[model samples]
Target: MEQVKVFTIDELMVATKNFKEERIIGRGGYGTVYKGLLPNDQIVAVKRSKFMDEGQIEQFINELILLARTKHPNVVRLLGCCLEVEVPLLVYEFISNGTLHDHIHNIDGASWYSWSNCLQIAMDLANALTYIHSIPIIHRDIKSSNILLDDSHTPKISDFGASRLIPLNHTHLSTVVQGTLGYLDPEYFFSSQLTEKSDVYSFGVVLAELLTRTRPLLPVRQTDQNCNLAAYFIQSIQEDNLFDILDSQLIVEATQEQLIFIANLVQRCLSVKGDDRPTMMEVAIDLGELCKQPTNLSPIEREM
Candidate 1:
């Protein structure tokens, strides 16, 4: 196993050219990410944290330790970190294609976003979740923006600043709520008790987003009044208009049977009660079986 290197602040400074604005690749509530090139010509993303407050420091340490132990193909690799700085910085393997959110929202990318590709991405994510959850880690925040894609469009789960590791003695951890708005688990939000199912609920939102290619908290269509994708998706399924809310591309390319199967799975995942949701392992198995089914699309459509 490769050890997580403790990088020097000076080395990171040179890699990012003294944190030049031109090197910036991403920005979030936690901090900014810069494209960095190490001395050995290895490309990486350097995350410069924003603060060193008690909570921030705790989160920083939590992420560092958890990521250091995690190993999964669909999980972003933490190459190294710099703790010599005031706020500290995390170094991650650079993923060239950007985030899943960027691709889904981009007209050019979404135009060719095939259902088969979407399903495979979902499977990759589910498997990643299964691995982390088995390690007893709750990703607390699992959303499209936190999911990065490589050149091959493979999804890798990222941003574990809000994740938690559950102890073997405890069934759940009672902690302050933390996660993306639309993807947050209602049961955990209300009770302040975090569990693995919280990730399942969040993953449900991501799967819903993938199938519809719509923002989790925004109206997909002007005629739609609902802003919450979870509620809107459940309502659509309950009202027997599931196909109407799905992406036009999905409806034409995916078999009706598979669409319904996945939609039902999504509904179960979004259940209000955590116990009602399926485990990540179960979800991965279901998706794997679905992917094995023959494609309904023609060769041209499959290539889309």
Candidate 2:
């Protein structure tokens, strides 16, 4: 692997053209991401975090160490970093295809992404999560927005701000629960005990997102009540009415067998009990195999 060099604050400023609003590609609770052109003419994504407390600074260091040690096609590559500035900045290879959430939920934008493309993205994300779990790191935050896409529409896992490195001997670590609400593992949320399974659970939610093509949480009916898609999906599965909840587009294109396979996988991942969920490795392997099989033409039988 090539060594990543630290950039000076001045250099980064110049590359980003003084952080122009036009160059800003994304923003989140932690920071903003800007598209930058380096002196070498290489395009990169620059993540600039807001103010960091002592503990956050330590977590930033941990993220750096983790990214530096890990390299995989499905995982975002760290090009360099700029820590000399007031707020720390992380440079990564630019992914042109944008976030999975945009393609799935944003109706005003392009909508040509086929069901096959969605499947590939999900498989790629699974591969990345499997790699992270192999190294014993729990992402704690796995969502459509966190999975970036390259020019070819290949998915790469990004955003390590909420990640935790677990020791080999430890089954679970007690820490302040931190993650997006809808995708968070319920077990971890209640107990504050995190494990790799937490990431698996979140990834399961991502899979559900792909299948349903809906936001994690959405308003139901005329009331102020909100419905979590994950919880709703699990309930639908139990009632044998999963088709009623699946994305209409996906249902039109996907075969019954294929949909069942994917639904079963999602159901297992969303198991309220972490012990019942499959490992990331197992999930990845199963999805990979599914990718290789040709889609069958059998029609889905509507559940009575």
Candidate 3:
């Protein structure tokens, strides 16, 4: 792959039309993402990070270097970057379908995405995580919002701002805890030891979101504060009420056996102990097999 080239601040500003509000595609704690069209007519998604200190700037550079080195079908492709700007800008391939979050939640009034589609999307994400973990990179954040889908409905894992590059020889690395609360690994929260398993845990939450069709966090009642869906899921599983919490649409189409299998996989992933969680490779293999089975095939045929 060709090395990612850096763009001048003026070039980026021009491409994004001075970061016009109309071009804004996404926003987060770190920055606003805008859609840009280069002079060559190449479309891109540009991330303009918020104000930062020297340490944060260095970290952003490190993230760019890591993104440049990564090239996988399931991983978001980085076109280049602009570091000379007041806030570092990251350019990535424009994913037209937006985020997995939007599809699952239908926040924009779109029809609910199919359960099978959700499963396929999760499989693609798992494959990406497997690739990232192969190089021993731990993506501390692995939620629906971080997954961008292309026009073809293929999912690509994005947002590596919170990722940690673990040395091949090391089992774990110590760092100040950072990650979305609901999706964080319980072990990492307590020990402050970051590992690939942390990513596994977060992926589990994503899997749950796919199955349940609910946000990671949401308000429980008008009178009560919001609750964490992950915690709610764990409790439901333990209480033998998984079906009650599962998405109604998914349940209508899924067989009892298929539901049980997926629930079991989620259970294994959300294991309180990080060591008990399956590796991304194992999860990918299981999900790939699930995806290949004929959806409308009879249970007898599936068994055969």
Candidate 4:
């Protein structure tokens, strides 16, 4: 655990070109992230928080404290911070290859969308979750867009504005439910009791997105009336229509065993009850085993 560096506002201003609009890379509930070039020629992501109220300040400091001590290969690294002004700014390592959402949905993009890549990314994220949970911290937000990619297309989990650190004796926390619409854990939403399993549920949704290359919140379609992806996915699996909703590329390229294995894993993860879901370590181990399986034969070819 290295100490987080304190950066000056002047340095940040110079790095981000005075916070120019064009430098903006991402915007979320907490703040906007800008692509900055440090004086040392290091490229970084500068997160400028949106509000300075008590609640907002709590999240900011929570993220700062949590990320300062947290260091994992799969999780985004918090390099420094600028607290000279009221609204604090955070600096993180810049991930060059954009997000998992971009690669999954951008069908025409140069990035590869192969099953192996998806599996690798999932494993990376699962490993990250396991590490974070071991520290008794809940990410609270684990979606495709929050997952950044390095130049090698490795997944790096980011965006900890909604994270929480659980006390040593507590198995769960009672807090106002906050998460993305499509990926939110239904149990947490209704009960307001957040557990690590909430993150598992969101990770399940991300896996579904990888297989389907569809948005978590599906648009209205002629045959499918359900707009929520988790419900749609579970329904499809139960109806034995999983293949119907899966990406055509995956159907052609992935083995039947591999697809079935991951589908079952995702289903278990998306269970309505948090207690029914597997731990992050379990998910990571399962994925590690799946990654070892050979991908030489496709489902279509094997059937033929």
Give lDDT for model 3.
0.83
Query: Compared with the true structure, what per-residue lDDT tens digits does model 3 show for residues 159-199?
Result: 88778888868989999998997888889999999988899
Residue 56, candidate 4: Cα error in Å is 2.2
Candidate 2: clashing residue pairs, number: 0
**Worst 10 contiguous positions by lDDT, candidate 3:** 217-226
lDDT of each: 0.91, 0.84, 0.83, 0.91
Candidate 1: lDDT over CA atoms? 0.91
lDDT of 1 by residue, 1-304 (tens): 3479999999999999999999999998788899999999999999988777877777778788899889999999999999887766899999999999999888877654988899999999999999999888999999999999998999999999888989988879999888889999999999999999999999999999989878899746653667789999999998899998899888877889999999999999999999999999999999999999876868787699
Off by over 4 Å in 3: 107-112, 221-226, 296-304
Residue pairs with backbone atoms closer than 3 Å in model 2 (clashes)? none
Candidate 3 or 2, higher lDDT:
2
